[model samples]
Target chain A: MLDFSILINNLDTYLEGFKNTVLASIIALIGSFIIGVIVAVMRIAPIKPLNWIGSAYVEFIRNIPLLIIAFFFYIGLPSIGVTLSGFVAGTIALAIYTASFIAEAIRAGIQAVPKGQMEAARSSGLTYLQAMRIIILPQAIKIVIPPIGNQFINLVKNSAILGMIAGLDLMYFGDLVSSHTFVTFPVYIFVAMFYLVLTIPLSLGVGYLEKRLARSH
Target chain B: MFKSKTSKIAGVLLLSASMLLSACGKGDKETSGTAAKNALEQIKSKDKIVIGVKYDTRLFGLKNPSTGDVEGFDIDISKELAKDLLGDAKKVEFKEVTSKTRIPMLNNGDIDAIVATMTISEERKKEVDFSDVYFDAGQSLLVKKGSAIKGLEDLKKGTKVLAVKGSTSAINIRQKAPDTTVLEFENYTEAFTALKAGQGDALTTDDSILYGMADQDSNYELVGGTFTDEPYGIAVKKGNKELVDAINSALKKMKENGKYDEIHKKWIKSH
Candidate 1:
């Protein structure tokens, strides 16, 4: 039988872990979104070095495994006199790692927009930046919503990496509970439920946003 | 219409979640039957016993990357048990288990016994049966040789102590040094690596394990001797009395034949 007793006894531990996980996911989501947008613009901009830097950041980050990035922040940075707490390190790693994919999605969406939209705006006396912001971005965003939603959902789930570095997230407490009680299956199922509590709502919210945006257009 | 569709999707998710739970409940029943049988008979029937050993603890069952084999005190003892039972030292199959995984893995029938650097405790006794203490170990601290911190006493507020997850050292330190922050890693290697990377002020674990780490690197040394007695034992599934008795007898024979001392000197004293 699944041990409900382990769950009841360690509710505080689970809740603490749940709190940290939610905090890490939220911070990473916002951080990655900002970085992703900036890099997306830089990659598509008419500048040369900016395109190289943008391409380099995306290619370098998306290629490496997430654990290595998290480890770099957690265990690597201290040698250079940059010491970050586990939560800070893990969240920052999640942001930097996920931003690469988000930037890719945004860039693809921007490209999918007809070139005439940008050309037409620039011909009508709008600057390139203004055309992008006014005419191009709004349309690109609608096209990007589905893929961006996918990345955000992935971002939430990948926040579990925080647990590996003892960021005290839900997965970390799940490991603690399983080790403490020697009950592995039930503990992880409950941890999954906690993650679902965060992710399911997020997924549904994205679906709803996609639908609403489509209707408004 | 959209509201109805959204509700339907939510309904499907809820139904699937319940299905997963019930499926797991069914799995629990299938495994219980095998657990009721005596493990000793099962080992004899199989002709070889699978024992879980740590693949990370340096001198106690660490996997040598070059050789592709795990070697240590715990591994040697496991082989001796296999030889005593199955009449050949090679009759043992090794599985890697960490401090967090060893107990569940044993209970789940993944291994016949756990020969990892496991500390016997009353709480764990409720989950699994332990043979007599094979090795007497104690909890201690490892820090840089010139560290200002000396021992458990010096671990004050804001001190970050690194320990392996699910280990007694992690639990013990929380109780002993209530004010200090205990950061746990997945295994000893990560904890020790974190210590060297300055992630924590000290690393805490069994002195035997700390000795292995200290031996591997000259910069770190054990401090404050031992704070808590951690008697290592070979754990089997709970209620496996026959297997427990056989292990105890096998251990006694090893002690009497001077085989235990020989193995200890090779792994422990040589370091």
Candidate 2:
């Protein structure tokens, strides 16, 4: 029989890989969100050095392929005494690569909030920090939601790169299964379906959050 | 700096977040029950063996789409080992691994042995033990038909030679041709594809792989004399003397019985 019992028999391995893939995405998403916020603020800062740092970060990371960045963490870091496994390298690269886009989205979002709102907050005896915390960020986040959602989707797909360094993500296990079974099409289709299984609910959740936030507004 | 306080808050948040996010998602093996222990005893006691082989390599270890079996010389070797150990070759489990994986999988106890086209080198010997060289492979270059690169001798600075990640071929290229900049892919197919894409001057790997690539695409031809002596060996964990001894004995038995030659001919002739 040409049926694929190999994939069925290898469910545990595939599931283990799925766990890693989701773990990497979760880490990358949180990492990029925090990084984007900081960079967005720095990019819009009046200080020259901070602005330069922000610009340099965006340009330097955006220019490099995510896999090269992954290699930097996985292989290059070891020379300087910092060693990371493939999964860590993949996640870190995912975080750093996605951060550039996230920061752009966030900066635009922050700027989109009416300048009058910040001015009003300042006139009311609030410090700059107080105004941003109390009035600016909440509104900026609303404008930033859609673009950030796209980056989230991208991060999930990019998580597949972990297969290169054997990060044991879903794609890595899928490769293992497909290579063994020789049912490349069905095995990969299964992997795609699994990815859909993860992303569909995530997209729905993002949509619901957007709707709820709009209703509150 | 009208919003100095705001900037400070942002800076702190960004730094903390980068640090915090970087902290999650780094680990080694997360093995559960049915996990591997002391490498030597694990295989002999388990009643069967799991040998890791390559999936993407052609002739030597390819997934035959029609048969649904990982066909090639390496698969035959793995099955022979199973027969030697457990009395039935079909009882052994096959785990598909790439060059990047075969080692970690071995170290983590995910596999009992690795019989892929793994070359024995001093650096790798530090990590695992190798059986006697089963196949004597010489380095060769695969190039598009009538391409300028004649052989390894013609390789120059910035001459991208495609190789798989974690392969000694990359290091070998560096050592043999010091000035060449090597472009590594994840596996054999990508290296060959990159070669076709003109990403490199030549694809340098074992002649077997280069020949397989050539067979797939007539535009590409295998060039270059064998420069480095890459002897393929079955890898077992270092200090797993028992498994090593068992594997070596099995090889010896198969070779003496002429079964090794028969199996080798079975898989390699088509390449």
Candidate 3:
């Protein structure tokens, strides 16, 4: 029922797409995590303006569609003389969009930490920044591991949108192969399998990490 | 708890797999049932024909956003065919189709025909029968007016060529200029937008589509005379000789009666 020759002949194309997807997802993962951390810190900081900016950023980004943000970078940025390749534009958009949700998750984790913990750190002569870095964040991250993992998984799936702007990701190449071969169902099935190959391992790793983190606590 | 979670995940995976298998079975069943009567005869008895047309292509078959009506060269051609076949121009239903979905939709009997500025190609001919060329187009380049690239020859190594995904233009560009990097977007609009944004050096597609883009924005112009001949045709299901003959006759009538020229003037003249 399924033809394997198309898959066999076009292995390189599929691999190129898979490589782009992995590269984009990894970059966006690291980029969004960093942004999420910073935004989460700002949201919890004592400075009012910083807190407002953080809150506004989260609200604005989380509320709008990721595609719009991607289009803004892909189509809107070039008008201002800031042109980026599809991969870069899509990664940046994915990072920015995902950061908002990550910020909320991190913030929730931070808030879940006992107030006494912060007071205890300050009483021990640790600066607020030091307390956040050396004390609170590590524990907050540990507590929020599952949610963050879920976000990471979502980030991988959302990366499919990169196909829209011609990022050369898996879905994009899958579309190309399917259209060229006119074997839509099987081509997509293979594409889905490739995605599962990326995501299932990540999902399992997250579950393992969650279990380990829970045991440590 | 870990065991339970693993089992749950496995259960969900199993369920989805079964669902997909069932869907494939259904698709096979649907595609197997060919109507014994010719499509033209069926359409005549039904008194309505379904045409799959592009809702995104601008001059060819774009849907008017404000009016919620599809209008363009392809739509006009479909209407004219309807008039010739059924004696009523309005006796046709329009279904939106993209390049990717048009063939599958036609094969599945979801649409009686495809009049979506589809290029007649040997590869596509194996899947569906096509009417005689209703519109003559060719592959061309759209670039910023002052760009260094003059034509297809300038599309050398490292030259970024943007084309729509699943389009023959992308394949043709690669064959014509193998060294040029081809980026395929979901549609011409996205590809054109990316060209304006400096995403690629040139946008390659049918000259008719490039004309539409050039018409929309004066800054971009068709850089090359058509590099590849792309004759557009109305497609029907493969082996539907009766339907193919009916469409070919209708097209011949349209040309003889000057209706074809009227449509060409309406959509292609300004471009």
Q: Per-prediction TM-score, please?
A: 0.88, 0.54, 0.89
DockQ value of candidate 1: 0.48
Question: What are the clash counts of all predictions, listed in order?
Answer: 0, 1, 0
By TM-score, the best candidate is 3
DockQ of 3: 0.61
Better of 1 and 2 by DockQ: 1
lDDT string, candidate 1, A28-109, tens digits: 9999999999999999999999999999999999999999999999889987888887899999999999999999999999
List lDDT for all candidates, in order.
Answer: 0.91, 0.80, 0.91
True contacts kept of each: 0.64, 0.04, 0.89
lDDT of 2: 0.80
What TM value does chain A in model 3 reach?
0.96
Across residues A1-217, which tens digit of lDDT does each residue of candidate 3 receive?
Answer: 8888888988999999999999999999999999998999899999999999999999999999999999999899989989988888999999999999999999999999998999999999999989988889788988898899989999999999999988889999998898767677889888999999999999999999999999999
Ranked candidates, highest lDDT first:
1, 3, 2
**Fnat for candidate 2 (0 to 1):** 0.04
Off by over 4 Å in 1: A1-11, A79-81, A181-190, B1-37
Candidates 2 and 3 compared by DockQ, better number:
3
DockQ metric, candidate 2: 0.04
